[model samples]
Target: MVEKKFTIESSQGLHARPASVLVNHVTNFEGDVMVHYNGQSINLKSIMGIMGLAISQGAEIKVTAEGEKEEEIMESLEDVLKEQELVKN
Candidate 1:
């Protein structure tokens, strides 16, 4: 498993658009992906789960991946998150 802690960069937090971008990235991997926020962890590929977090700007989140290609997936996710200005890990 691989995990990276990120501080949410978007002022609006993990809203719809950004959540979709995250979900999209997660779906590309065949491994288990999760986002840890606050004290809870949820499936990264689930839009509803992500939105339910209601993460705010500057909130710290941990993106984790396990199983095959976990490292690559996590790296790609980090890139996209940075590109989207969503989270700085």
Candidate 2:
């Protein structure tokens, strides 16, 4: 498993578009992925799960991946955060 902590960069936080990008990235990975905010954790691939997370600006999220493609998924997840997510890790 791999984990990376990233701080939210977008003032509006994830909202809709950025969350979709995150969800889409998670869905593409075959391994298990979980995104943790504060002390709660949710499935990264679920749209509702992500929206329910309601991440806010300056919030810290822990991106984790486990299973066969853990490393790849971790990298992919990081890329999404850096490129699409309103945050940096």
Candidate 3:
């Protein structure tokens, strides 16, 4: 598995739209992916699971992925989230 810790920069954090975006991204892959927030972990491919976390701005989250191609997926997901949040590389 690969993991990355990042802060949610969006004012609304991972809400409906962002959550759906994240879920869609993860679902596009063949491996398993999850996002950990506030000590709770949720499947990255499931919007409902992510929404349950109710993340907010400044919240720290750990993104992880496992299975074949997990390393690539985890790195890409981290980059995507940073892009979505307008974070610098």
Winning candidate number (lDDT):
1
Ranking by TM-score: 1, 2, 3
Candidate 3 off by > 4 Å: 86-88
What digit string (tens of lDDT, one per residue) describes model 3 on residues 17-50? 7677777777889977988887888888888888
Q: What C-alpha lDDT does candidate 3 achieve relative to the native structure?
A: 0.80
The 10-residue segment with the lowest total lDDT in model 1: 80-89
- Please give, for residues 1-89, the per-residue lDDT of candidate 1 as tens digits: 99989898889987899789889878988989999999999999899999999999989999889989998998898888888888654
What's the residue-level lDDT of 29 in candidate 1? 83
The digit string of per-residue lDDT tens for model 2 on 1-89 reads: 89988888899987889888888777876878998886788888888988888888888889888989898888777787788747654
Instruction: Show pairs that collide, candidate 3.
Output: none
Score every model by TM-score: 0.94, 0.90, 0.88
Residue-level lDDT for 32 in candidate 1: 96
Error of 3 at 45 (Å): 0.8
TM-score of 1: 0.94
Clash pairs, model 2 backbone: none
Error of 1 at 13 (Å): 0.9
Quote model 3's TM-score: 0.88
